[model samples]
Structures are given as C-alpha cells and as structure tokens.
Target: MNDMAYGALLPETPREFGFFVDGAWRAGHDWFTRTSPSHDIPVTRIARCTTDDLDAAVAAARRAFENRSWAGLPGAERAGILLRTAEGLRRRRDEIAYWEVLENGKPLTQARGEIDHCIACFEVAAGAARLMHGDSFNNLGDSLLGLTLREPIGVVGLITPWNFPFLILCERVPFILASGCTLVVKPAEVTSATTLILADILAEAGLPGGVYNVVTGAGRTIGQALADHPDVDMLSFTGSTAVGRSCVHASADSNLKKLGLELGGKNPIVVFADANLHDAADAVAFGIGFNTGQCCVSSSRLIVERSVAREFETILADKMAKIRVGDPFDPQTQIGAITTQAQNDTIMGYIAQGQKEGAKLLFGGRALDLGRGHFIQPTLFSDLTPSMAVGREEIFGPVLSSFHFDTTEQAIALANDTVYGLAASLWTRDIDRALTVTRRVRAGRFWVNTIMAGGPETPIGGFKQSGWGRESGLLGVEEYTQVKSVHIETGGRTHWIAS
Candidate 1:
C-alpha cells in the first residue's frame, strides 16, 4: 500500500465535535475552531464547554464513582478494559498521530511517537492494576489480625497542556482508571482533537458510562470548574507554574482534593570541560528545541564549563542552523511551529529580552519568515549570566540561554539556582563527576550522558516549585489511591479500666 493509502485510513479531520460524557458524544451550543499552528488553518471546531457541560461531566464521573461500576469492577476485568483501550489506540495510531499533528503543531514523526507512548502508558497502567496488592499480618499480637488495603481516591480531574495533549492525557488518565477511579479530563483549548479522539477509542474499548469524560474550553472557565468541583476527589494538572499555583489554591479552597501538579521548568544541561561535547551538544539541542521548546521540562538553560564554552557554542550554533522548521507534517522538519500565537510572542519577547540584557544572539533571535503560521526561529544565546531574566525564567519556546561556569561547583550552583527543579541533564564521562552532579541537582529526574530516555517504567515529576508528585510507574498508581488500615481485637479484651 502507498503512503497516501495508509494515511487515508487515519483520521485527518475530527469527525465528532462535542464533549464525551456518559460514554457517548454530545454536542453543545457553542463551538470553537482549533487551528493548526504549523499552517494557521482551522483543523476542527470543538465544543466550547460551558459551566453546564463541566457540571455534567463532573456529575457523570461522580455517578461512575458512587455507582461502583468502575470502582467495583474486578481488577482483572478493569485491566482487560485498559488493555483493550491500549490495543485500540495502537490500531488507530496513525489516525491519532494525524489528529495530534493537526491540533498541536508538532512534527508528524513526533506525533506518531507520542501516540505510541500513549499506548504504552495505557498498557503499563493495565498491568499495574493486577499488581496493586495490599499487605496483611496475621501475628500482630495474640489472636489479633491486621490488614492494610489501598482504595481508589474517588473521582479524578485531569487538566493537560496543549504541547502534549495525548501523551499527558494517557499519563494521568490511565493511572486514574487503573486505580478504579473515574475521570473528567480537560484538554487545552488549542489542542483537543487528539484527546477527543482518544475518548472515543476508550468508549469503543467498553468503558462504561460516566467512567471517563472530556470537556473542552478555556482554562479559566472549564479548567477552573474542574479544579474547584467539590465532587472531584483528586486533581492532576500539568501546566505553567502560575496556573499550577492557582490550581493548588482552588483545590485548597474547594474540596481540598488530592493535587498532583507537574509545573514549568527552566531545566539546565551542565556540560563539563571533560564531557563528551558531541553528545552533550546533541542532547541539549533535542532537549530545548524538540516540540518547539513547548514542554514544561524542556532544558531551556545550558550551563557550560568556561574551558569548552566557545567551542561548544560554535558546534551548537552550527547544529541549530541545520534544524528544519516548517510544516509539522513534513518528514524532514525537526522544529515545527510554536503551539500558539501567544507562545510565539512569548518566545520572541524572550529573545528580544535576551538581546536587551546583553546576551549574544549567536544564532536565531526572531520569528521565522514561514508564511501565516506561528513559527519562531530556533534561538541560541551565549554570554549569559545567571541573573538575566531569560536565564532565570522558563521561556517555553525554542530559545536556549547559555551560561559559562569556571568550576563544577559553580555549574552545580547555577543548575540548582532556578526555583523550578523538574529535570536536568549532565554530560560527563567521569562517573564520579556524574554522581556528584546528579546528587547535587535538586530536580526530580536527572540524566547523565543522556536526556529524556525514560518511559512508563520511569516516574516523572518535579521538585520545589516545578510541582509536586509523580506521574508514571508504580508510584503514579499509588498516587491515585488512599491507604486504609484495619485492626481486630480478638480473645482478651483487657481495656484500660483505671488508666
């Protein structure tokens, strides 16, 4: 079969344009168009969820939780459903990829990879369901029995970002469902097609009514509703640090829901003079430029040892020049368009700010000449200090700020100076150096000689203001559950009579 024939089987357009509630699709009065960031064309018109829609989705999730259709299902049965969902995702991988590319302005190749990762997430969560076992003790005392069990934390509210709609949804929703909790997911307004498509796939995989729902709208309206919903027992959010703070405050003021947030990061890549400069430069490029630098964990800061700083900058600039930035569907495109116009402006503003702060713009420092779409050049800035705004803040765009350090201690200090500690990478062949750097870094996930090399098996989260709690692995499943202890008094009931 030809490539076009294969592509035809995939969903190029979002056929269903409504919120998924109570196991089916339903249209709303208001709808909004989702534009392709790469082409600046309307990809699909999705339902703009109102407060009523949010209430309905939340109510459905609450019903699913209270009715125990999901919570009371057998572990193996729930696992089977999840496994089927994963299989369905695999079968529709190409279509899901298309939707992701159209809605999010990521390259089609990256979108396909994201779809595969989403499937893996579901499969891992399915397997995790069987492994969610509790402990028991029979000889705690004479004729006494003790038991401990983990139960689902009721309804879950998942709010995902635009950059990685499908991947983030799978990361949170699968674990929530595996833990026997129903969910109401709110995808970012700019990128909701892939998420809505996944909701359909889940329904096709035999998820019951109210088990999973999707609401689409602005964060202020729909997302805030979910965050403040009293029935939502737990809330998992992936977004900016400012927005995450709002979620925390909302949860505290509302039902005090269990909150898990993966916020923004100005992640650093520290390169020592003795490090593998070739590998380090490649990793830095991928970490910062991939997804057009829209990822919260994107390594926006590069801290290089002064000895190798000049040579490394030359190599990095040469490499950044070669990266193709254009249509996301193109096979050769490495850096696609920025996800949104606001993000584009934000990125360019940072580039301008870097220039104003006296950082040398070694390469791109402006928007691309690409027609119509929100495209920005992959920017690299050198001669940066730790105090500069561009160096200190999370620029969520394809912009890298390089800072030179004289010693390993300074590198460590510079890397750990940011308030956000999501993830960081170190490039060094010396085992002692890698160990020392990894130990000193305050981030939740650290890499040595490699970056972004984990999947469902590895837990991903943040430290400090980067956010709280993990999102993958067994720890992710545990995060969605509550522990309960049971104790029984048998035989001798010697109470404290006089005490």
Candidate 2:
C-alpha cells in the first residue's frame, strides 16, 4: 500500500516471468534464471526464447499491423491507450522501481527517477500520436496539388539494454505506437522482469491483442532474429556499438529494416575556468557517477581548464568519495552494486587498462562484496592523455577520467576526439562560449552548464559510431513513420518532359 511495503509486496521472483504474446503470458520451450545484481539471488527464471519464439512474436506483430487492429486505431484512440499506459506505469511505479534497483544495481532514488522518466515518455508520446503530421507543398506549382502522408512503418523489433531498461523501452515503444506500428520487443536478459510487467499492464489498459509482443532471451538469438527477420520493418536497438554494428549487418542481410539505435558513449564534459568551480565539480561527479556511469550519455571524460584542474580534481574526488556505495534497496545509498559480475570485470578491466596506459589513478579501484552483490568503489583517473584507453573508451561503470586543457580550442579538440558522439556537456559562465562550444561539439545532445539534462521531450541519440536515430521530441515521433508524397492534377497537367 505504501512505499516501504513495496519491497515486500513486490515479488523477488515472480511466479511467471514469461513472454507476452498475442495478449497473453506464455513461457518459452527453454528458460534461464537471472541472479540479481543487487544481490546474487534468483531474480527470475526468464524464458530462453530462440529464433523460433522470435518468429512467433514477429508473426503476431505482423498480423496486428496487417489487420490494423492496433496499428490502424485512430490517433485519438491510440493516444487514449498510451495515456492509460502512462497511468498504469504510475500506479505500479514503486514496484517497478524496486525491480530496477534489484536488477540494475542502481540506487532506489535513481531507479525512482528513471520510473518517473519512463512515465513521462509514455505521456509525452500520447500527445505525439495526434501531432504526427506531414507537410503540404505549394511551391511545386499551383497546377499540381502536392502533399505528403506520414504512415507507420509496419512491425518493429525493439532490442533494449540492461541499463535503464524501462526508460529505453518507454523512449522507443511509445513513439513506435504513436506512429501506428506494432512491436516485437526483446529486453536484455538481465532486466526482463520490468518489461514483462509492462506488457501485463498494457493488457490491463486494453491494448489490442498481438499489437505489442515480447520474446525474452539472449540478445544473440532473440535480437538477431529481430534484426534479420524479413517481416520486421524496423529494428530499434539500444546497446553497445559493436552489437549495433551487428544489428545493421543483420538488417542488411535480411529485411534491410530501418534502424533506430541508441548505442554506447564515451561522452565528454568540459569545465572552463570561468565556470563556478563547485557547480562544475558537482556536475562532473554526478555526470560520471549517476546510474553508476552506466549510461550512453554518461560524462565519463571531464576536460577541465589547466588553471583550475587541481582544485576541480580535489573537489571532484571529495564528492566521489562521499558517494555511498552499498545495497541498492537502501534509499540512503548513492552508488549500488555493479549490475553483474561481467560488468564488474569490465569496469575493473578498464581500470587496469587505464593504469597500463599510464593514467594516474587518483582514487578508488577496489572491489567490495556487499553481502553477495558485486560492489566497487567509485574509480577516478587524472592526467589522462587522448590516446589513453580510459580517456577514449566507454567503460560503463562508476569510473571518471579527467584531462587538463589550456584553451577553448584544446577543450573542444579533446571533447570531439572520440569516434563516439552520443552526448557531451560544457560548463561555462559565458553564454556565448557555451553556444560556440555546443555548435562545435559533434554529439547529438549537448548540455551547457549541465550534465545529462534531458527529459521525454528532448531528443537523444548519437552521431558517429555511437549509433543513429533520435529518441523523444517531435523528431523522435517522426522517426517511426515513413513519408509518402502524393501529387494531384488540380487544374491541368503541365509537362516539363516535352513541349
């Protein structure tokens, strides 16, 4: 009934954490159990869906799209469903948030915030359904009436990641629905429960059967099917750049499906000497440390002016040390356990690489065991060169690598050095400098004097190898629909081909 009771009221392992297909919950022929990141206990025995299962889910989505049962619903009706879905998520927020903490190994506070954002994604997308529009073209000439029709791209396959699973789904699925497309979702195996719960809530909210299907398993089998399925029109994936490349290739080999990928980031945050030192320090700490630095837009690289580098690093290290790394369920905890042993290894490996590359380890590289959970102290590195692995690569963990820059040009150069252009931040008192730096940075999302500042309304994605296609905003809504241009002879046809 209340907040604290939710941890008990919510199931640690649900009786049925199965696939949702054709408006019903079903299990796969095979299954695998997930041990919690918060604590190494059984979270759920998730369905180990093969390509065959993926095929069935895709078929369901295809049928729904072809039948126009869900996809053909009027925008207003669709909007109503989306709005109701948002409300449904609201009702189950605490439960879902708890699960996020358990599975993701993020603090409960951060999990709650993610839940709020997820709710916002659906609510904003409800409005997007009505706002999806095409343009009228009169410049083509008065004799011809020309316009474009924006229509859904048919069945879409969604492959989401473990980090921010609920938020990514909300970012993707709602917009896909808003554009009148049916979905076949493959959530990350580590965090499949929340999505299953979401499917159930959608059913309760009266979502049409077969409109939103789920197939859970390893990304290799399930996600590969989605990418390569001939029936799937689009593949929206959020994961690492390497996996995203695989999705592209798979799509090319099979359906040649449209792709919406929100991939990995080695994002940069620059703090000029003119900026407020404390404020800059705060942003830097939170940017790299929030969600345990397991975000596409995590400001993992901080480029500070050489004049203030020492002071900033001291303040930043102090803030990082203050971050409480403990049980995710504890509301007072700032940093939770590493999501999985594999991720913990990856983080520690990166730390080792940073050391190997001669980056100065300023603070925290020790791993701790919080009961059975895999825990690590927040890691920090200074005197990092552009060529260093720590500075260039994306280590999706609670790690921060700092660099010193003497001039704006050097700062911009350092920020833009990486192949990934997912997101970046700049902290400066000068608005002019902020604007200039923002324009120069190649990332899709840029935060001036702020870090990881965006909501459901703000578009988020990457440029280079980080991945493509934006999420949220009107642009995000537009990404799900294809445009068809039409021309009609109103007065008479004027041929430009011949006289």
Predictions in order: lDDT: 0.87, 0.85
Mind giving the per-residue lDDT tens digits that candidate 1 earns over 25-105?
888788888777766556788889888988998899999899999889888889899999999998999888887887788
Candidate 1: which stretches are off by over 4 Å? 1-16, 495-499
Clashing pairs in 2: none
Clashes of each: 0, 0
**lDDT tens digits by residue: candidate 2, 340-444:** 788889999999999998999998988876556788888889997778888888899988999899988888998999989998999999988998999999999
Best by lDDT: 1
